[model samples]
Target chain A: MANNIYIGVDLGGTSIKVGICDENGKLLHQMEGPTESEGGPEVVIKNIANYVREIVASSSYHWDQVAGIGAGITGFLDIKEGIVKLSGNLGWHDVPVKKMLEAHLGKTVKIDNDANVAALGEAWGGAGAGIPNLVCYTLGTGVGGGIIINSQIYVGSTGVAGELGHIAIVPDLEAIVCGCGQMGCLETVSSATGIIRMAKDAVERGDKTSLALVEHIQAKEVFDAAKQGDEVALRIVNRAAFYLGKSMATLAVVLNPQRFILGGGVSKAGEILFAPAREIFKRFTPEPAQEGVDIVPATLGNDAGVIGAAGLNLHR
Target chain B: MANNIYIGVDLGGTSIKVGICDENGKLLHQMEGPTESEGGPEVVIKNIANYVREIVASSSYHWDQVAGIGAGITGFLDIKEGIVKLSGNLGWHDVPVKKMLEAHLGKTVKIDNDANVAALGEAWGGAGAGIPNLVCYTLGTGVGGGIIINSQIYVGSTGVAGELGHIAIVPDLEAIVCGCGQMGCLETVSSATGIIRMAKDAVERGDKTSLALVEHIQAKEVFDAAKQGDEVALRIVNRAAFYLGKSMATLAVVLNPQRFILGGGVSKAGEILFAPAREIFKRFTPEPAQEGVDIVPATLGNDAGVIGAAGLNLHR
Candidate 1:
């Protein structure tokens, strides 16, 4: 019998990443292409199909060895139906991604939201490897999450199970309206945007801080300032970590996952952000739920999406 | 071949309730006996075995029809090994229940925590029947929770996945210590114990209310007073309902279960409790997650425990 392989596509607004993974979820080969999403879903999907074909053809493996194809899409997806209900990033709606990609590549195809795919990738091939139950938090512009249970992505009744960012953690008195129109969401205080907004609010109020000296305030700058012992920056960083840790404490009782994997750019802030979150998680979570659980950083970096998407064919 | 039947044991401190169920999880027959817990694990095991034999012999079915036996125990348990690690109610520690029961009956046996068992009962034969994913809350002395996913109890990595009562939902400012040592837990505010405590606090503070006139206030008295338009009692009920609704909203984005099943004595308050909780769940949950999701009462009541135990053999 011939060895089987999987093809994964990480469909982004600007560039689409493609990778080939062996049965063990190892990325054997990879390639990328321009999305041209403005040309619409048809063009973007065509680019994905071409890149997949090119990657497989370039590798030593033949088309027959490609067991299936899966794509990690950034949008509200009808995962069961393989439809992209709405994708603001791609300016697409109601696109039958699986059908179109299967038609173009003549292979079985599956699609899932980006957060879920990335979490699966981490579980299958990255930090969460060998762990059947864990949660992955992508702390970038927004706080995205994925719940992996028994080595599979846990998409709840409405395909919205792992929306950790939207958890209403902040008390109503201190909360601001989130882009999702909710007040006091975890994202409203923990996301990069939230941190920057807090820093901007501090500066406008004339608080004493070195961040006032920076021309542009990004999450990285705030972390750097906090590392330099800037009081205001440290407060902002702690505030972000506070809600994150509190949310994890809630998840501890609800899911009791064995591990929590943090990924994405904000997670790159490292110990400064992690220390406070860990402390708060310890303070809030009960002892039994936290006994074997540990918080760790994601290892796959930018490749989690493609790797996880490839795993969809196997894990799903 | 005769149709197979399952025996379920609901082991409480004072009494042992046993039932027989068919493959479909219907409770065909039930009987109860004194636990005599002071007699220790051996006596309890013997009683369970005798009850099983009696129920089978008394029924129209033959002894050969018994497929398996399962017990729902209230305590810390090592589910996989079927050991009662520490059951405060049973005064048991490190009792290998599955081995003891199997030794007597010569049949396969399984055990799970009471909360998970009750939730499974609701999922299999009551309110959550036919629903693949739902969450059940037993609002008794303490708040107990069970997560049902894909028609089975979702016990997390360490078998503590559905400890929803311990969610740290109350904000720090208004937070109180929980029995589990955590502060601001949902159980501290939403459980019957919590409601009774609030009623007592209101009376102690000399708040003008009818509850103060009652010599001893139970959760029922508080609910009854609130139904008659007592402002103090209404405030306590609403507070309890508030946290319940908030926790459900949190579970909405985390688990996205299709239905929320509320059971136990506190839930019997009916519209006064359900109406406020439904409104708060709607107020807090995001539209997409809340869509198609409904909150309803658990229909099985006390029978949920036995039926759910019977289902352990099938669902586990």
Candidate 2:
């Protein structure tokens, strides 16, 4: 049999995770190694190539069975050319990932933003599998988004479409500056940073709440407090859910995805975040747009990037 | 010889415009007639079919040369089945336009929201022709939007995608209720209604401005007054541009379109509106997303709807 396997690389700052997947999008074998960024782009590229080779070499599938390689990278990139324009985490700029990988391994190479790859993974193997149109949100330190249209990542003209977190949903009086330098972006109030900021502000204001007693507050603590019906925590949670729901309403009209997959640590807050957000989504969106749409959690967890990266050959 | 002609119908409350286009998207022939909606949905459907047949008969092309018929309509619809779910303009509900038209004319039929059709028209034959990814904004009494991805209309999961005007861009403090029943939508500040409201508010507040001297204020008067250096009018115009620009910035990150085509009467204010909006778009959008994007006026004007509708069969 022709090596029907594909290699997937998830390039993070600290580590580079590589995996082999069959044609059906199932992850069969995986391995990881340090990125060694201090050794520069050349060393990192060599490490990635070595890791891919080792993973395939160690697997039952032969080299000929390896169909292609795909990479999921953080930050701005020229997706078609496989150039990492900028990655804050890896401290890379204009690194030609595809050309290098192809030269080393003699195979077709594809790369996309990490967020987009994760969404593709979910759409391929997780909650949104088989759905033609879906959007995924990673609600971690920041809110990141990916959009799939007709089963392909809808990278806009500049190859940077699906920046869903930056959509401005807050009205001006209550709006705050987002890290992207815009005012009232969904990320400002709905991301993990936003949730923590709200909790800290509540504590700083000396609100009579159980959250005040926590030695070091975090998003989990806030969610736990809200689950326990702590008034200040509930208010903060509601505000976050309100903006998230409002943004979903806006997105419901724009992309009209069949389902919305929520991921990342903050999303682990579960129903406390989802209930209010879903209610608000129904309230703000028109009935036609809201019909058949769903909001659900992601299933792939840390493996989404690698699997999605592997899927780039078939999906993107 | 095979018929390459496509028929387009632009259905409105007061009038129905029809035209024929070749495969190249050139409008070969055109005509207009009253909708007579008071005669009800059956009469309206009959009139549309009659007009399409008559136009083809009168044109150089024969009926067999007519490849397909497309209609651009207002309000909610079941696009997949060519059913007009509800049209406030034509007083229609559950009108089976595609089935009726197809049954009458014995040809394939397609339909879309007027805004979406207008966008497809621009993308097919007007301002955005040759560009695969674009967004169109119609700045009339109320704002409307359409999105084109890979030369096809992105009609979301429920055929209501591209509701750009409803994107909540304004901060809560300044938001007014939109016609769609949402609070602080972009339509509340950026539409012609929004412009006139701001001008009227200025005059009612006894502010010093050239608009105060006009017997009756309108969007044009407000723009002219702004062009004439009326401080109050300038404030009103700037606010409208500010929100329009802000919304574009939000969309830029989400869709990353190559071009933004602005149409409708309000957009005729030209630089007075576009200059500020473009400035704000640049300020609000990140550098990567901002690259190579242009904001320009829509070219087709009154013919956009018919041309866009005609394009649906080929593009959609």
Candidate 3:
């Protein structure tokens, strides 16, 4: 590895995690702070700066060895221009994030959408290591994806690449509404909310299961209940797996990725999630693609974000 | 611009089209032949050799100046090995096509899946020219795709990259059975055969429309009838477009493509096929991608296969 060190910042809706990393993609030090998103972009920027400063101060390694800094924030972005074009929850439109951070820190900064950065993190040092082409999808409050091809991120002609959550896994039939306000999106059916929606729908229709008797429930409750042999919860998780597997099969035909690493909060359901998902994938994917494709659970957990973000800085 | 010439061959069950071109992708000559696919792999090899000899005899270009030859065939493949691993339609399996043809022609030969070659042709000389990131989908008897990134084909770890047809567009419960032995594949609902299948299903259910009374049904026939005010046919075609559009939206996410070029036989339906597809695309795709992505019809038409194959030679 080179002698260079780098900085990593993970910008989430409620908090920010900042860290220092070596060129080999090792995290050296870390710091965190509340995003105070309601206070708006300027406040979040200040918080990000504070977090970065704390990491620099705390690291045993000196700052002079750092090459630059990178941030992973949720939004539509202009990677080439170093701007956050539109982030819904953040209410940010065309913010010159790179220049602002560079101005404050006196160091160069590279900012990418959080999902994109997470994908870069995975590709560089996490679950996707050594893979030339892959897609990392996180099923959380919403769905997000990162596309990596030939060891580099595929940022598209524009920067809005790998938005898998918005793809119409279901189309025109009045399915769940995606955050983008579209109907029948893969997001509506594959995320945690989607899983709950499915179980709730089954109950409303009088499908007999243990979940039908539960007080309000979430996707995790469903997965936990499924592990305990709840028919309704098991059914709901299975439904999500079916779609997730189908989506992977479709993804296979488009990108022909050698590996697919599933992560995020909902992925914790484990084989109750992956087993059926893989079964459906084998059933639905074209024969040739099914031959040797690897569908693995993401090795990185919560650390994926901070670690992946750090990895991004070192690699970039 | 180089003086070196190349030959491109497109192999299908019933017929084959071959073209002669220069290194810059300029076509110099062409020929067509019956595939005689029933004659088995050995006989087909002989036919390919004869076709190459005929092309050489008719060309004024010097044989010494020929750089290489390429072939694109309809089958699952081992691309790097230049083997046709399987073909349900043509009954081919594990045939060393490249070595046989290279030896017969006394020059190097390369082979690729037909869809990949089509994408390559567009990447080198057609609509996707000057663009390295693109997804080329063929709406033929089945939906097929090839991904191009950074001015070259991305054939995944197993040479099965770009299998767009097999992506499960419909959730299993709501999906139709695809010919590839699965439920709800994009190809089952979106290709030329897929459109006809839907039309037949719709008509069988007793919905009155222009196509209900037709003696023969084809994908184009349904599209033409729908144009003249047939409710059932219109519904069928729109439904197919809906699935196709949604699938493309998913592909946009999966591949982060700069362009989505629709080709093959059914694309001839034009706006009727594309307009609704565009609507679904815009509605479901995330912003930036929704605004920036291009869904254009393929430009090479029938000659795409040959040209694309030639491109494979020049590129791979």
DockQ of each: 0.87, 0.59, 0.57
- Top candidate when judged by lDDT against the true structure: 1
Clashing pairs in 2: A3-A64, A3-A65, A171-B171, A171-B172, A172-B171, B3-B65
lDDT tens digits, residue span A53-109, model 3: 777777666667767888887777777768988888778888898888888888888
- Candidate 3, B9-38: lDDT as tens digits: 989888878898776666678999999989
The runs of at least 3 residues in candidate 1 whose Cα sits more than 4 Å from the true structure, single-residue gaps closed, are none
Lowest-sum lDDT 10-residue window in model 2 chain B = B166-175
**Per-residue lDDT for B1-316 in model 2, tens only?**
6768888999999999999998867788999998999999888888998999889888778888888899999988889989999888778889998998888878999999989999999889899989999999999998989999989998987787898888766666677888877778888888999988888887888998988789988899999988988889999999999989988887888899999999999999999999999998887787778889999999999899999999998998
True contacts kept of each: 0.80, 0.71, 0.82
Give the range where candidate 3 chain B is weakest over 10 consecutive residues by summed lDDT.
B283-292
Q: Give the alpha carbon lDDT tens digit for every residue of B1-316 in model 1.
A: 7899989999999999999998988999999999999999999999999999999999999988888899999999999999999999888999999999999999999999999999999999999999999999999999999999999888999999889899999999999999999999999999989999999998899999999889978999999999999999999999999999999999999999999999988999999999999998887888888999999999998999999999999898
What lDDT tens digits, residue by residue, belong to model 2 across residues A120-154? 98888888888999989999999899999988888
Tell me the TM-score of model 2. Answer: 0.91
Which candidate's DockQ is highest? 1
**Candidate 2 Cα RMSD after full superposition onto the native fold (Å):** 2.9
